[model samples]
Target: MLWLDLEGAVNVRDVGGIPTDDGEKITRGRLLRSDNLQNLSPADVTYLVDHVRLSTVVDLRSPAEVAAEGPAPLTRLGHITHVNHSLLPEHGFDATAEALLVRRKREEERFPGDPSCAHYLGYVEERPDSIVAALRAVNRSPGAALVHCAAGKDRTGVVVAFALTVAGARREDVIRDYAATGERLHLILDRLRSSPTYASSVDSVPEDHHRPRAETMEAFLEQVDKRHGGVLGVLGSNGFTDDELDALRRRLRT
Candidate 1:
């Protein structure tokens, strides 16, 4: 994972240069994973727009989160395409932010053990359509596509892992990218703590809850292979055709 040195977002990184199972590296500047873009500085905007040529912004945050945070700077600029593909259930869109987070935590904690892995799997099992759509957006992007959630750890991590897996990125490399978020957890949490929408949610949760463990993502990939036949199977089952899959591979692989 190549960390993007931006003044606004802390967990932003390039999901490129990952070695595939077939021995090819994912093309750089084609895909990016990031945290919220609600605080992007002027220089940050210029860098992403002018230098990176970011063409698509796939936001994994829920409708409530988007409403609370307001429009991101890129959205206002109107040059880039911003698509909200919320991984969480939209049934609770009207709920308070605290209530929504509480509901999410409860769902993740449903299993006494392995809450993190379970939560990761929930994203696939619960909202496969959104996952498919997000990737489709990436497939259609004319330039680099930026995927992001609130902290760029859980939801964003899940989607990026799925995309990389489908592109034949090494399993260990995918896990490494997911676990890399732990290295910047403090900065990510600090940024979230400053937001009214996320501050209360993070305040009640322990720091350990935010850490991205490799084992969690490892088990997630394992379960996907066991249950869905793999990333391609998940995508196909969720309405993504072979053409779409090929397009995605073309966009990511070198």
Candidate 2:
């Protein structure tokens, strides 16, 4: 993971040069992952748009988040294609507090030992269509594809992991990439706390609770394997065709 030092988003990084199981490397500048882009400075925008040549933004944020946050800097750029594929259910942010609690409880029950893993699984189970569409957007990006959610942790991690897996990246490398966000948890939390859309939720939890764990990702992948055969299986079952997977692999691999 190559970290991009941007003023607004701390958890931005290029997931390039990662080795695949077949001895190939993921091409640099092809795919990037980031937290919210709501506060990006002009220079940061220039760096991403001009220097990085970012072409597509796969925003995994819920509709409520996008509406709450309003237009981001990237959204104003005429050349960039922004695709919103919320991995969570549409009612995610609009639900009552009690309803949210009930959903979280059900997610925990999905994998009693690891709530994070279960939550990740919920993305696949609850919104597989979004998952497939997000991957398709990445594959079709004209240049670098930047994937992001609120904190660039859960939803972003799941989608990026699926893309990496489809690109033939090694399992350990995928888990490592997912856990890389933990290194910037403090910055991520700070960014979230500054946003009215996420501030209250950020304050309600202990910071450590937000840290991404390698074990969680490992278990998530294991469950994916067991339940759907693998990432490709999950995508296939969700209407993502083999030809699209091949195109994604070709787009990501060197």
* Top TM-score model: 2
lDDT at position 98, candidate 1: 92
Per residue, candidate 1 scores C-alpha lDDT tens digits across 121-200 of: 77888899999999999998998999999999999999999899878899999999999999999999999999999998
lDDT of each: 0.89, 0.92
Candidate 2 lDDT over residue span 1-254, tens digit each:
79999998899999999899999899999999999999999999999999999999999999998999999999999899999999888788778889899998999789998889999899989999999999989989989999999999999999999999999999999999999898999988988888888899997878898899999999999999998888988988888998998999999985
Query: Runs in model 2 with CA error above 4 Å?
Result: none
> Best candidate, lDDT-wise?
2
TM-scores for all candidates?
A: 0.93, 0.98
